[model samples]
Target: SSVMVELVGQMKDNLLLDFGEAKKIIKEVVNVFDHKFFINRKYLKQEDDSHFQIQFEGPKGMFELQVPKNTTYLLEGEATVENLSSEIIKLLAPKMPSNVEAVGVYIYEGYNKGSHIISNISR
Candidate 1:
């Protein structure tokens, strides 16, 4: 009877150890999966050779983002933008003065070559 009691105690400890290790492995796997989804483009776009190629590259301001003509980006979906560099402000200030308040985002796009640029200003 005493032997059986000791055996049960040992089995409980073994189960606890196994469960702890399993939990640790699961947590690590979950973290890796999240990183791939969130910051990395691992699953964001369709997998193609073009997908792997660079799309847009520029300094943080006055960027020319290619978009389908007349497409609108939702106000809620705006991505983060840092303080506009002085170079960017110099180009913009001449057009829209005073009203270009701090912490505002202005999105502008041109359709065809030499077409008038339509801008959406948000604050």
Candidate 2:
């Protein structure tokens, strides 16, 4: 299994600026968590015309909880979903500008195709 996290933030006037900031923030977040999990890669993805996301992939076993659609399930052992989700928001909160709100953090898990596992949002 593999783990992925999508960082969503408010859009700015310049798309490049938003993307660049996202990249930098992602790097810092990944570095902090790297000690606990092995991150494979990080990339910027356009969620829609107005939203862009910074997404990163890491090895499995990093998350102990998995929620697909409506059901919630627990895995063997690792980081709890709530802990990781909150930690990510905490790491992002200080780095982000006031205008650029850290809207949501979505975590996914799977071997081939990722399934929406858990998420945390700050409005």
Candidate 3:
């Protein structure tokens, strides 16, 4: 049976200013959820043009998700950290197959917590 994933945002945007920093955070977030969620890193693949890639392996098989880097958005508004993991989860949940056994989400831990929240996926 597939499990449903839900994320309740608890913090404000502390968006990373550097692209490298942002990509690093996303990678860590993925590692966090890989275990119980059966999200194997070996199977994960990032987009050639962007770092925001979401990959998952389940009983039903593999799924990939990514949002093209919006340079225009970054240039217009100062890059502020957003709960990207939450955003991805919300976008992905409804589209996920019902047989997905686990759910994972990454939440920003506010500026005081760290540069970014540790990589994580929920089950």
Candidate 4:
């Protein structure tokens, strides 16, 4: 099993139509992970038009992704930060808006970490 890792990142402001759009996109990605992963929408919460949080669980372990209307996102899960970050970017790229240029992700794991730039999404 992999150690738990947290990934924090951001997108351009107003990158999503609304919290619903964010949830839908997330659900799509989660579903792609197969039946082992399921979102717990009951925990869904929104502080305002610009912020939202979604939680889910899977074989990898509990996962949480937060989108703060400002387009900032935080994702925590059980996996190597780099591997998890890349997997997310790869899955999300095809679903993102055509205008999205890139997403910057910073990883954290027991005080050891690094950053990644998932660019050329439109490509």
Q: Which candidate's TM-score is highest?
A: 2
Total residue pair clashes for candidate 4: 1
**Winning model by lDDT:** 4
Question: Rank order by TM-score, top first?
Answer: 2, 4, 3, 1
Who is ahead in TM-score, 2 or 4? 2
RMSD of candidates 1 onward, in order:
25.2, 16.0, 18.0, 14.0
lDDT of 1 by residue, 1-123 (tens): 000000011234335235455345434432332212111222132334322311333487433333221222211221222111222233333333233332112322233312122233232
How many Å off is the CA of 42 in candidate 4? 38
Candidate 4 lDDT over residue span 56-75, tens digit each:
67699997776554443333
Q: By lDDT, is 1 or 3 better?
A: 3
CA shift of 36, model 3, Å: 30
Tens-digit lDDT track of model 2 for 15-91: 42366766778678746654443221223332334333335345852332222222211123334554455566666
In order, what lDDT does every prediction score? 0.26, 0.46, 0.39, 0.51
Please list all clashing residue pairs in model 4, or write none if there are none: 50-69
Error of 1 at 121 (Å): 56
Tens-digit lDDT string for candidate 3 (5-51): 23332223442123464345445544443322222234445645554
- After superposing candidate 3, which stretches have Cα over 4 Å from the reference? 1-82, 107-123
Selected candidate, larger TM-score, 2 vs 3: 2
